[model samples]
Target chain A: MQGKTGSESWQEVWDKSVNGPRALIDCWQEIPCDPCQEACAQGSIVLSSGICAPPALHAETCNGCGKCVAICPGMAIFLVDRSIGSGLARVTVPYEMRDEIRLGGEAWAVDGEGNYLAEGRITRVSGAGRPGRTMLLTIEVPEEWALKVRGVRGRRKLLEEPEEVEAIEAVEDFAFCRCEEIDYSRLREIITQGEFRSLPALRRFSRAGLGYCQGRFCQSILRSQFLADCPEEDREVESFRVRAPVRPVKLSRLGGEDG
Target chain B: MAFNNFRILQHPVLGEKKNGKEVRIFLDGLPIHAVEGEPIAAALYAAGVRITRLSPHKKEPRGAFCMIGRCTECCMIVDGEPNVRTCRTMVRDGMRVETPRGWME
Candidate 1:
């Protein structure tokens, strides 16, 4: 229809489907994506203005068809139908892997922070469409985990279990202080203790702020933790410490040809 | 007989780039100028400086392996700093460097 937004098309989908429950398009990222809208047969999933706009689901009329869940390129959408009883929500999501994982298999659920939650059952598994690239799996999880549980696990599977795949995300490992071998935990502990109030004091007590990496990793963590623990303390530490000769060198480079 | 190919320069995704810098520095008081900004080990190889450091427990001659800094074979004392990661850290101008003999000073 003329001047119709995705909300309008999704409203039509709600009318067509039975018990159309509204599902929040949980993909919070600001990126261009709209496959879910096209995937819906009933026109329930809508991203009409632009791909960057968040997808909206007509909860009351959404038939739990699981089309939007499977077709989301960013995998940001989840079909949450909580009306299934005992706070148990049914979640339909996409699975990409060469391994033939079956339905009703026990899957571990975890949150965004890598915290382990309740394990759920794989209620349904189906590979649809040409080439069968995406496997749509229905999972029955507690209402709490419905928001968090993203993927499952498989043994030596080429397609890493969704949860595992997200976990291995390439966050740069903190260049731990090598001199005294102090890490994030040690820094946290030192900050929590009132004795060493600031980064300079913590460096004095433990060689945390010092070392070749020069507090690139622990500086921010230490500063925030220190501030969080002791708000009244006015220990202002420079956010970035610039160590002289930012790069390390070898002894041989200084001396010449006389071996 | 070669068993495992443990070479620092040979990486799958990254290749050794020619670091363009010519300057002199001393390693344990020996005259050498490694390519500035290249790994201390790579520059050492280019300048024919072997025996980066002696192992802590083994006391054996160790060179750079696993240039990604997982292996501590290339750890050495540089400008009075011990256990310096030569592989990961780049070379600088007029840097005073030394091969670490053991764990202690």
Candidate 2:
């Protein structure tokens, strides 16, 4: 049979087409990952270049195959059919929790940060992986929230009750630079000094990210505070940590000698 | 302890599926063996290397979490650098290692 013709709708592609799916994958991270590229059987998704590039769809050409949604490593992609007319969007997303959620269960829809914003109903559920690990959960979310709700919390933590965002201790006491052994107090002192009013100056002086792990640990926290100190460089400073062999091992391991 | 008593003798999920070369590496001056290709955190966890880095504040203990790089709980100093995520990085042979303490500069 010939592949999906250009005349078919996205729903027809969802029902019968095997080439591409109408999915919106929200890549909240710029991390190095590319499972989605390998997942597409129809060549519907094109991320053939770098792993960090967003997966793009040829709107007139895609046939709605759901492979990309199931294989995304970050669980950041989703299939949506917003043209269904009731202001209801049928969303197909990856679920990684081991909870016992029933069909039609009401899920507290959340953003990437797990913050609850709206509610959604489970429409369809199927195990999405080879080992039957992750679930490809299809939910009926309000069209307004279709772009907002990236995930759902199946297992509610006890500490998730609504609490005001206040830190009992000043942010300074919280250590952002574990390598520099710079606690919030020391960081505060460094910030208080007229010579160092921002994170770059602090990073330069204390060598905050110059440790072994290459700032994979405290860079985000430091960046947050750094942006707070100097908002002018916020966008540039939010750049991600350049990934290396971020893990630590002994020199003997890389020696290539049979150990 | 007998070899079978190890927690990673073969984990039900991650352990048995790991098919890599077994190699030895040193941690904080002690020789420890780890499976090649797996992240340094799994090897360290198998070898019981807790305290990847000391807290810059009150000096509390921290280890691996969000085994992926999303959570920064597993950062340590390897060789002469700092802030390494032990989970994302694959173990190579003979890499210098260290637990990041504070202010290397």
Candidate 3:
């Protein structure tokens, strides 16, 4: 792996002769979580330092059980089998992207940073006996690219295509009050430039809280902005005034016309 | 024609959406299809009905924000009731939804 952080490298594990298959614990961070250690039946996963230390794998004892791959909350564990066939390697990666890549489908293998490496065929997609959130994808890659490939590019372009709008321009145009159609710049002006010291005064001036929501949603946002610029002495000012009939009541019911 | 932009065909994590019973609802007198028990705002968004109501003072176009019921941006007239929170209200068959031009219906 290009971004391998732990002391032991994947190349060192591959050099050792294992019985069947072995897990490559890629977890570099010292985070507090240990479901992967407990999932292993052979006790191959060792957290020698403590709960927060990264797990170490005993490659000789690990039977490529894939228990750590499924139970790992971080989804950092992978199962690599170099003895699959001649010039072929099988790498089981934690897959949670979507239903885009299926069994026997062509998958574009990617590195840690999602850079395209090589195309691999999806040999298996397993989520059985594991939480529905995380799935395992087995891809047969070239033996040379086995250690380099980390994940498969699955449905990234289709889902994220619509959100390519310029973020800086979008922020200025983003509406703070959907009912009032008040954008961020307009709201900021109302809070900073407007002479309203209190939320009610600002609401009265801007007609922001008077919308159908009755200030339920935009009140907090307005308050934070107001407090951000307002002096410490004026911080105790009252927020938006709440009125009766909080829930929307029908006109007929309010008028008692429908008896 | 029904709008298809907001319709999630297949989600990466949740997989395919298992929508409830399909039902008909009216948006400004135009008949639209929606899943029963889903928020009216979701149906309207799926149909590409972005501007649900106009601001009372400036007539600014407004649509669903904070898909949760907290934001009244998605409010519209539902079944003769003014200021109904579409994001919170569930869709019912033959439900009448009207996007009033201004505050007064």
> How would you order the candidates by lDDT, starting with the best?
3, 2, 1
Candidate rank order under DockQ: 3, 2, 1
Interface RMSD values for all candidates: 10.6, 7.4, 4.0
Q: Which 10 consecutive positions of candidate 1 chain A have the poorest summed lDDT?
A: A13-22
Task: Provide TM-scores for the models.
Answer: 0.38, 0.41, 0.76
| Tens-digit lDDT track of model 2 for A1-259 | 1222222323443442223237565663456777766776766656535876556554444444667777777776677666565767767778766455567897767776778766778877776333445677777777666656677666476374687886677433555565455667666566555365444556777777765446766677777766666565536643443555556554666787542
Candidate 2 — which residues are off by over 4 angstroms? A1-21, A28-31, A128-132, A154-259, B1-105
lDDT of 3 at A138: 87
lDDT by residue (tens digit), candidate 2, B2-103? 212344443312324445677766677777777788788887877767677666545678888678775567877777666677788777788666776544
Tens-digit lDDT track of model 3 for A44-112: 777776789778777767788788898888878787778776777788888776447778988888788
Preferred candidate (DockQ higher): 2 or 3: 3
C-alpha DockQ of every model? 0.05, 0.13, 0.49
For candidate 3, the docking band is: acceptable
Local accuracy of candidate 1 as per-residue lDDT tens digits, A24-95: 465545468777778877776666477887666655445667777667777655555566667676666666
